[model samples]
Target: MDIKLDDLTGSKIAGLINEHLQGMALNSPQESIHALNLEQLRKPEITFWSAWEGNDLLGCGALKELDPYHGEIKSMRTAKEHLRKGVAKKLLQHIVEEAKKRGYQRLSLETGSMDAFEPARKLYASFGFEYCKPFSDYKEDPNSVFMTKELFKK
Candidate 1:
């Protein structure tokens, strides 16, 4: 799969992001849903990427700059038909590399704490993200699990 910078203007990515938000709603409480919509993902602070296999959209992820040295992982989702196919892992690796290239010192993320989000939590943990208190503007929510990893800490 090829990971490419995405501008978030394509209908295919929009539909996938909608699908992700819809799924998040079904799995988490309304207040704990932090997944960004297309407009938010298009913000100047966020860099979005899409993974494709030629003409097929496989997965996507984004890095949102919280500050000059800190970044947040956002909007990670794999196509429903491509679940368990390593598409997400590849996209995530790409995002992490991009974060390091940008000189970020840390990477953080917020995901659901419920059983429905088990796969996501596990995925993050495997990537070295450890549980932490909320970062950025996030508040503690029982439905949310906050995690972070030091990318280039001493």
Candidate 2:
């Protein structure tokens, strides 16, 4: 799949993000739901990307700058047609590479603690992410699972 930097105007990417937010809201508690809407993801501090194969949108992910050396993962989702096809893994690896290129010393993320999120947590773990305490503007919430990975310059 081709990973392309997106300006968040594509309706496919926007729809995927909205789906993620809706899923998060359903399974997570109100206080622990940190999923950003399209408006928030369009902020200058966030860089969004969409994976495509010709006219098809395979998946999308984003990196949110938390500080000079830190970044957070956001809006990761694979299209229904692309599920179980490594689309998410490809998008995640691309985002991690971009984060390292940007000189982020570490990458972090917050995912739901529900069963619906198990696949996501597994994907992150395979990339060497480990569970950690809440970071940035986040506070401890049982419904939220935080993970972080240290980046090595490549």
Per-candidate TM-score against the hidden true structure = 0.98, 0.95
The whole-model C-alpha lDDT of candidate 2 against the native structure comes to: 0.92
lDDT values for all models = 0.93, 0.92
Top TM-score hit: 1
Backbone clash tally for model 1?
0
Candidate 2 C-alpha lDDT tens digits along 5-112:
999898888788878888788888778888889899889999999999999999899999999999999989998789999999999999999999999999999998
Give the lowest summed-lDDT range of ten residues in model 1.
88-97
TM-score of 1: 0.98
Please name the candidate that would achieve the greatest lDDT relative to the true structure.
1
Candidate 2 Cα misplacement greater than 4 A, ranges? none
Clashing pairs in 2: none
lDDT of 1 by residue, 1-154 (tens): 8899999999999999999999999998898899999998989999999999988999899999999899999999999999999998898888889899999999999999889889988988999999999999999899999999899974
Model 1 Cα shift for residue 42 (angstroms): 0.8
